[model samples]
Target: MSALIDRDEFPLLARAPELVYLDSAATTQKPRAVLDALRAYYEHDNANPHRGAYALSARATERYRAARERIARFFGLADADCAIFTRGTTEALNLVAASWGRANVGAGDEIVVSGAEHHANFVPWQQLALERGARFRICELAPDGRIDLDQLRAMLGPRTKVVAFHHVSNVLGTINPVREIAELAHGVGALAVCDGAQGAPHLPVAFDQLGVDFYALSGHKMLGPMGIGVLLGRREVLERMPPYMMGGDMIEFVHDDRSTWNVLPHKLEAGTPNVGDAVGLAAAAELLDAIGMDRVRAHEQALVRTAYERLSAIEGVHVYGPAPDARSGVVSFTVGDVHPHDLATILDARQVCIRAGHHCAQPLMRRLGVAATARASFYVYNDESDIDALVAGVRTAKELFGHATV
Candidate 1:
């Protein structure tokens, strides 16, 4: 994995030699391949796809369809048309809430979501339940921050319509058992929706193998650009739901009184799409595939192990989330007498970039009894030197705050 980072390939990392970027969970740094692919698409094939028949349009359509195929193949989906492009994970979840939830979930139905979900995953379902007169249920989190599977089983019943949860907790870094959870949802005759924003980039995600009805992911969280995300659903299930957004390109025909909708994927993707971002996302997925997810996961795991050991050794530092062996790359902690915002500012002076906020998981933060925490999350390019810089930064912050030890 060390060979994966060639200084020549990533000129930005070389340019900012002192910067230790540990915020991969928020968004990862793009590789040269993804950047070049975006550049090449805008330079050569800059045309609206699927509508025009000229040479440029033909090339654009080919590239767009190829991207769908690449993403579908990456997730081991049978049909590329099962995937739909959206703004990000937030929009993807909203689509599910508006389209599938509106159609399948009703007055007596129940929608179950985990307590540890990001606001993107939680609010959409909550809103849908409220509007449709459906019962909204929350699955409790265990002491270690993972979902309480026993509680989840007890909550699932005939009234349950959809079971929504994150594949990995953004704050806790607790990887959920998607296959088991999906089976449990199916046992209760409910659809399972997985928010894969955090999981897709760090681990190997095979949508079919996970047995989920719907899986949502963001491009930026991986190595792709912003404003692009994906929602992969089972073909038969998606076909049953009404279109979430109504506009051009999503319709087969329009009349004064009624309008007919387009086919599977197109029906879901409305209006002018984010073509360049989709191209960049495809390139990002290709880059990750080349590196191999297993290798990427292993690289990040080693970094997390080292970070956990070093941070835990500090006297006044309190680490959150699962133990080192039971976690992903995310490490959240608090320095004694220093607010997370202050700790972040101190760390930033040393060129150490870490996240300090609710991390979009305010409910989880409340559960942990902290308003915010300082988080250092790792990725493929992060190494031991990065962890060392973080350790040194924390020590400097402790000393600057007049703490004799830590």
Candidate 2:
């Protein structure tokens, strides 16, 4: 591990000294600082926000607002008013599909998404297109899982209403050129929506500089607790859309016949907010700030490049995606004649944790001509020894399956 990361800061990793956890692409383990934040919120400032006059509720409301501001600044936003809290990345993406997508995308209009998107970023747009009689076009990928930019350009036209994609691929680990994609969308007068669940955790993200109209990220993917995420939209764009859900906190004046919605963020946040998780996520942002995302990215890529090289040397192993230089920290591979589930099970016996199956990327699996591939992902706490354990486990799986190895 790099000097920037203290493994002891994460209670779960410190408790399981023998565990080789490489599934950070799914969710990262929470640090002690984040844990402490959650406990403090519940112990002292537990109350429903925005409706009460007591000191407890006031404190809760203030903490939630402060967290929103801190997180917005972390992501390079001008203010917290444009950012809305959601359950996670899935809900954030769905909120856009329900509101902005439905409002702007009409019959004969087109929605273009990359072939390498996770289902969270793919399904909603597809369903919206279907429901609204719009064309759902898939921009194909190159053989190495990189987006075919030429194909994407050819597909765009005056009818293109939205161009949605991931900042970093969950399966291929390819970091898509966000600013370039956003520019292309703008060239066609289409709105660009980015799923930042994979990018914000590993890279330094400036939301405005990316030029996207809207962006979404999950807290759990970046050392915060589960069930909390954010959706950031441009003020002008958000002001034009209707509320995603109609309920208590989202409304301003409710009458028997009709009701008016609240302001920018509260208009979309329909229910009681997740105050504790928000506080925890804010603490996570602080930790990442102190460690610096640049160092974190360098460390993980070095480990991944090493792992990719070592694994490719084995006789039965076939790694997928572009070269190590083009990828983030994830490596997906298949062992000869062994199912990914079986390989994952064997690795579990050695106290190793990795993700298997399509990784919520079934389309990409079909593109690769396989049903599934085993994935090992890295984070700040993972070191070279974890990659060694992964390689050894792959070799053992090959040996047990009667496959010859170098």
The candidate that achieves the highest lDDT relative to the unseen native structure: 2
Q: How much does each candidate deviate from the true structure in C-alpha RMSD?
A: 1.4, 1.3
TM-score of each candidate structure, all chains considered together: 0.97, 0.98
Cα TM-score of candidate 1: 0.97
| Model 2 ranges with Cα > 4 A deviation | 1-4, 404-406
**On residues 241-283, what C-alpha lDDT tens digit does candidate 1 reach at each position?**
8999999889998999999999989999998778888899999
Clashing pairs in 1: none
Error of 1 at 70 (Å): 0.7
Q: Give per-residue CA lDDT, model 2, range 295-334, as digits (tens).
A: 8899888988999999999887899998998889899999
Residue 20 alpha-carbon offset, candidate 2, angstroms: 0.4
Q: What value of lDDT does candidate 2 attain over all alpha carbons?
A: 0.91
